[model samples]
Target: MKLFVKDLTVIDSSVLDYSRGIIGQSWLVDIVLHGDLNEQSMILDFGIVKKLIKSTVDELVDHKLIVPAHAKFCDVMSDGAFTYVDAWREHGESIHLACPDQAFALIPTEQITLASLETYLTEQLMLRLPNNVKQLDVKLREEKIDGAEYCYSHGLRKHLGNCQRIAHGHRSTIEILRNDERDSALELSWAERWKDIYLAEHCDMVSGSELSLSRAGMAALTPEHYCFKYQAPQGEFQLAIGKSIVEIMPTETTVENIAQYIADTLAKDCSDALTVFAYEGVGKGAIASA
Candidate 1:
């Protein structure tokens, strides 16, 4: 008997590359188990599978940063309650992250990849399954679109729930309406600005800090770095990264704030009312107008 669960949603919080310092990826998960029918005359109850799988995945990774421990450019330290990371880019630029233990997953892989993650997840799920279960298969996928979309990662320390973890993100599509007409150019511009970017609140940024390298240095290869620290419901979270890759908002980095910012910005350009649909991920988000 084969049992499967499709479209298990998860948010991947991790830093995959130096250029894209921190990425919160929206993952569509699929799981399959091969096993014998139990006394209940079923491979496994769908309800049980859904509950267990969702909880396991959520508890393990959902909003936490997934760091590749063996990566040459990555160095990690942990003191039970907190984890610190320093990652250097190919050209000597770097990103530093410090957060509560619950905010990160230190993986054994040399690099963080879907395949490596799947392997790790499989090992975990296998141990939790019934003895009759023989094969466990897991698939992780990102939503793809032909039109304009942006990949971004962020952490919301103020959130009381899982979002309080220092990293998690989305691949989202935005829609802008100018006088009730779709504006592709405006949508594209927003997408381009947030592409592979990190969104942070202005209040979280350190004040009056000049952390960037000197202009006479390799300006193009080395981006100016900025540091931010804040306390949330979970614990203290700190992040340092290239200033050029960050999109700072006056308000919190929630979808509601994003939409409001867009609407207000567009309103300044014209007298017509503007509506902004800012998606945090697929199928849901906030809509605001000005």
Candidate 2:
């Protein structure tokens, strides 16, 4: 499927300020984009394209990313389009996106006019048959190491200040082709309470494990709780599973039903989480009522 961005620019021009950070100047909107497809021409489970789009948006609109290197251009602007590139890298296999056309070009941070370029790209993307061609992509275009730093140190007390080692950090330049974990993730994120477990399928799982205790089961606990397991084709990891708690007595219920039911009941019974996962596999339960 093709991705469609309804509006490319946020209309307001006067509200941007340093207090709220650069993201405060960004437009918020629902984004729908396609994942990579396979030999059967089916959408891969990796959600590569989807993640790329959202992450790119996040990079452009979230965290400390709003700071424009060019402070001079912060003024005299009504509109601009901030595009993101989702980068991945492998030796040979990869996915990529390119400018739909060259009509849209990137200006230095100083020349950007807030909503001006954004509005232009927005209207351009909406036009049919590549006439406007303002669409941009989050894709990898190169292979190189991220930048490094050099620190300094003082004598006697041996204080620290400058860099001393070589550090290599960079984003991936390959598009995800298929990943069962993220496939299950994005699908669940869209649904209320739970999503279908195409991910928790008939695979290498222990027989006694409650397959029904959907990993989405954590939603029953807390969206903020860090509880998730992910496996990708190359490398994999889970985050934020610690610092969570689910208050439920499973003596009367099967393990299959316990986690989810507790999640559901906790949602109703407590103002705060009953169980907490402080970090990793470490978990705590039965919080005192306030």
Q: Highest TM-score among the candidates is held by which one?
A: 1
Clashes of each: 1, 34
Give the distance in Å from residue 91's predicted Cα in candidate 2 to where it truly belongs: 52
Any runs in candidate 2 off by more than 4 Å, and if so which? 5-23, 30-38, 42-46, 71-107, 111-290
Model 2 Cα lDDT, one tens digit per residue, 208-246: 122122233322333333222223321221212112111
lDDT by residue for model 1 (1-290), tens? 78888896665565556556676677789999998988998877888888887888888777777888888877787777777777777655577776788888777888888998899888887888778788889999877765678877887867899787656777788898888998899899888888878888888887324222222221322337767778888888877777877888899888898889878977887798789988887778899999
Clashes of 1: 1
Each prediction's whole-model lDDT (CA): 0.77, 0.24
Candidate 2 TM-score, C-alpha based: 0.21
Q: How close is every model to the real structure, measured as TM-score?
A: 0.90, 0.21
Worst 10 residues of 2 by lDDT: 161-170
Q: After superposition, how far is residue 128 of candidate 2 from its true place, in Å?
A: 24
Candidate 2 residue-wise lDDT at 8: 29
